[model samples]
Target: MNPVIVIGVLSGLVFLLLVSGTSFKPFQFLGQGVIKILIGALFLFFLNAFGGQVGLHVPINLVTASIAGLLGIPGVAGLAVIQMVILV
Candidate 1:
């Protein structure tokens, strides 16, 4: 087969796939999870920055980020409460 023919076929296949409306639920879920984790990390960063004044520091890790990401503000609040309760 000629190289140009092979390349054209591959490109055509790719274009067809793009127009096929394939369901990518898993990828969407994964992407959303990653976005949530990043948002969680940002939240924790700000929390540390401002909470430092009040001696409240929540470590930003995978677990914490997941919690904050999945559970939103309440999760961050819960972590803060746990920290204060345990350390104080």
Candidate 2:
């Protein structure tokens, strides 16, 4: 198992997985969720983008990220409500 051959094989497998749809559904969903949470976090940041107007700053962290990842948009809404009712 030469180093070059191992790397090439790994790359080829990754390429194949990327090219093939329905090959591994769970991984695809996980990948999408990871990207979604990151983007959602950014959206949360700017949710209160204004200095002092309509700014909803949901602290971006593991718990929030997990909530966003698992519950999607609803999770964000829930977080907002929770923040308002409790933290504020």
Best by lDDT: 1
Task: Put down candidate 1 lDDT per residue, 1-88, tens digits, no spaces.
Answer: 8999999999999988876645676788899999999999988898899999999999999999999888999988998998899867
Q: Where in model 1 is the C-alpha error above 4 Å?
A: 1-20
Q: Tell me the spans in candidate 2 whose CA falls farther than 4 Å from its real position.
A: 1-27, 50-55
What's model 1's TM-score? 0.73
For all predicted structures, in order, the TM-scores are 0.73, 0.54
Candidate 2 residue-wise lDDT at 29? 86
Q: Enumerate residue pairs that collide in model 1.
A: none
Q: Write down the lDDT of every candidate, Cα atoms only.
A: 0.90, 0.76
Provide the lDDT at 86 for model 1.
Answer: 84
Instruction: Put down candidate 2 lDDT per residue, 1-88, tens digits, no spaces.
Output: 7999999999999988886866678898889888877877765665546423765567888778778767777887888888778898
Q: How large is the C-alpha RMSD of every model relative to the true structure?
A: 5.1, 8.1
User: Cα lDDT for residue 19, model 2?
Assistant: 69
Clashes of each: 0, 2
Question: Pairing residues by index, what is the TM-score of model 2?
Answer: 0.54
